[model samples]
Target: MMNITIKRIIIGICTTIILLTIYLLVPQVSNPSPSYETKLTHGTPVSDDIRAMLTPSIEPKRTRAIMVMQDGKVIYEYGPTDKIMNGHSTRKAMLSLLYGIAVDKKLINLDKTLSELDIDEYIPLTTQEKSATIRDLLMGKSSIYLPASGEHDNQITQRPKRESHKPGTYFFNNNFDANALGTIFIKETETSIGEFMEEYLAKPLGLQDFDSDNVIMGSPWFMPKKKTMHEQYYIYISTRDFARIGSMVANKGRWNGKQIISEDWIIKSTSSHSDLSNNHINYGRYDGFGYQWWTASDTNTIWTDGYGERFMIIDPDKRLTLVEQNFTGNSLLSSGLWLMNKNMDSGLSNLMKAHKTLAKNK
Candidate 1:
């Protein structure tokens, strides 16, 4: 009888284990993860006057989403804010945040040379490339001139010849610098960038949308050059979550009183490290480059612009963050670069107008 009871108990335990495994494997459709609170009580609604100013700049079908957060509350949002969209070069800013955290933890040394990291793939690095430091890459001054795939027309046209300028002296807006940095980050952290982001950033910030699965490796234009090593590689995240990133920057790397990243790193990464006045490619409104973010010539606002006019703008003085995602089609040519630039410029201008209007009404 005792032997029979033991067998029954074992069978019961095994069934329970199988049932638990199935339950965990199935997607949880009912109890979804928590996201940022609206907190509409804290801020005034976006006035109709401001909406009129913004609507002209944003095309409903072409523009995926736009979100505005002021003083830690959602003040305005338009379009499908919950939709996941690709963040092109804007992913560079996200990578910059990870670098800051790694630096703070002593996991990565900014002064480390590329040669020391043993980061070589597809094409071997030249001697000059090896000498570039991590800091140089962060500043977009890594004078390792190489033909980076999927680069903008301006970047390709303006790229300096190999060995023309010493590392840390010239700025080229080279995607190779950013891609190489991603490789180095992986070498130092022993974690994929996407996994690291999910564990350290997304979960901690209470972001509703972001996962390892959403992290795309390489651009289709550049195959065989390691996805993680593609500077043009992207992360697909919701506009609201993207705004949270800008909000963190505006708050000096703090989220809800917790220091997600060091305040010093935030200052250093957002401040103008390279003047772009003479850069061959005119970013139009932007005149300076920080670690990976862009800075306006006259304002404290720091921003990141993705291809096709996707942008995340952070204004520290005003304690405001805005994210706009315009994902229309595969080719950016559909919108044309000129129109894209104009759209971004107008969007930003109208956002400022909205802010002023809200403040005036209050």
Candidate 2:
């Protein structure tokens, strides 16, 4: 019996030693935190005030995440803001950023017509749709049409089918419409969309461990996974890095004193490129679309939207970046926008008040 007990003790000690060695060698904790040091006159007390502004007006059935960064400091964060979460179509914002970098590098000409490029095979649009330029698709004006046709239809109710249009006249979001962009990305860049995202946007932004692919079709994650649908139709990002990307956009795509993407491209991508004519189409409190980015003309806050309430809102005038993630439907996006507008309204008021107070003391 003593021999048996001794053997068990020895095994336990060996396991503990192995774990200790791994703890030391693996370097689990990241060192030298991501650079957030930048100068701004706003005092740090606003973090508390911002947190107070995040109380949702509605009963919280959905999971909500929020992060606010002002002047390079994380002023406030609420809810499950640390966990990795889906960023729905908000991924388009990063994709647009990648597109801009491609333009800046001369890899793509934003004005280049589809016919001149001879990459018509990828786009399933008819002749009219084929005439649509890269800018058209970026601005959400492509002839691509979704199955539901401007209604709140879930993915399960729809299987994306290609419409035989004249190829540049009308736009919809079908499989062909979404996948064609991926094909064109591969053809021109000689790299997959995932590769392009990494090489251009994510890597430079220090999101080296991110993952994204052109998922052909699947339901929103909140829905039960469908049969035979191997992949979902969006990019997943941790909420934290999602906020990091927003901060980068708010700073005009600069991180850690490095120009990850050109400032001019950032500006153009986030501004109002075109007016979405359809009154039925909801753009989450935005007045217009700008190269995959949504612009709130009223607040001058440009944002990228994802399905399931993922948002990366950048307020240039206030120098604030807000990111929010929610599992519920458009309510998160709508409410988050409402909450953001409230915070921006209140936060700026506080800062101005603080400035006035300082002025009086001086």
Candidate 3:
């Protein structure tokens, strides 16, 4: 009788485990969300063959990815776009969009001097560095000079003497170049950069999943106590999700009939408002800079650049957009000449030609 009782208990436990496993493994089916059509302007046309033309070039690059959204529709998408790829200064452009939202909500005034706030408390530096304004930082002309290049290359050295280029005159991406600005946002809003970003931009834009996975609680690179920012590479976003961001910008910060960011800030941030005309940051592209965004040679072309050849290209004039994400290599260690760096030029050239053809047809 004792043996039988023990056997019964074991069988019961095993049966329960099997039941749970089946419940977990079996897929649950539910009503799918309603599909929505992309809004295309009447008579507007994008070349039907653009994706076909671009695909042949993509495979040879090995790690290349591409996605095109015409008038808010995923006309084409390919490769590891949903992968958590490293974003270098492309993040800087996204941060610029968030800054615009902060400005719209009166959290921080673009003209407000950084010295007026407790920016010094968060980032250690002299009054000169602290004197930089939000506008200066956005314009990439803040005199806050630091010796760093590319992503994760945070080697900052204060110039013994400030340069004569004058504030709001040059462009640099030193980590110290953006550090004080983050501190400025914190001081003005009584919150960290990441928190302010979520409250103002992500939530409104339906981007809760951005920092949901692989969160780094507080920033690992900066002063630890601030707890204002987090630094994790695993921002889980798909090509379409990223294209949605570009669409919002192309629509003047309006997302699905809602204003996610102020239209005025959108114009200022994407325009060629910088003094540095047609400057090349990576290799052989003469794109202009505005705030943190890059203005393409074409008046209507604007983009936010990311590391590993990731790009969110927006052309409002043509009512078209494209977002591509790939894991190429760190620019600093990129062996000087990688195929990925050249990918944009060839891709954009094809895209531009396609756009022109479509325009002519219309």
Per-candidate TM equals 0.79, 0.64, 0.68
Once fitted onto the true fold, the runs of candidate 2 whose alpha carbons sit more than 4 angstroms away are 1-47, 55-62, 115-124, 146-178, 208-233, 277-284, 327-362
User: How would the candidate models be sorted by lDDT, starting from the highest?
Assistant: 1, 3, 2
Question: Judged by TM-score, which candidate is best?
Answer: 1
For residues 1-362, write the lDDT of model 1, one tens digit per residue: 99999999999999999876664444211122445333222366566776676565535535567788876677778887766666778888999999998888899999988888776545677888888899999999988777675577777777778888899887788888877777788889998888888777887777776676656556433126533344545677778888887888888988877889999999999998887888766778788889988898565678898876687778887778877787533333432343554543326566666655654554
Error of 3 at 222 (Å): 13
Error of 1 at 90 (Å): 0.4
- lDDT (C-alpha, whole model) for all candidates: 0.74, 0.56, 0.58
- Which stretches of candidate 1 lie above 4 Å from their native place? 1-42, 56-59, 219-232, 329-349, 352-362
Give the winner by lDDT: 1
Query: Higher-TM-score candidate among 2 and 3?
Result: 3
lDDT of 3 at 19: 77
Show the lowest summed lDDT stretch of 10 residues, model 3: 28-37
Tens digits of per-residue lDDT, candidate 2, 147-245, equal 321123433243333444443434333333344444455567776666676556665666522544422234422344323211323555555667677
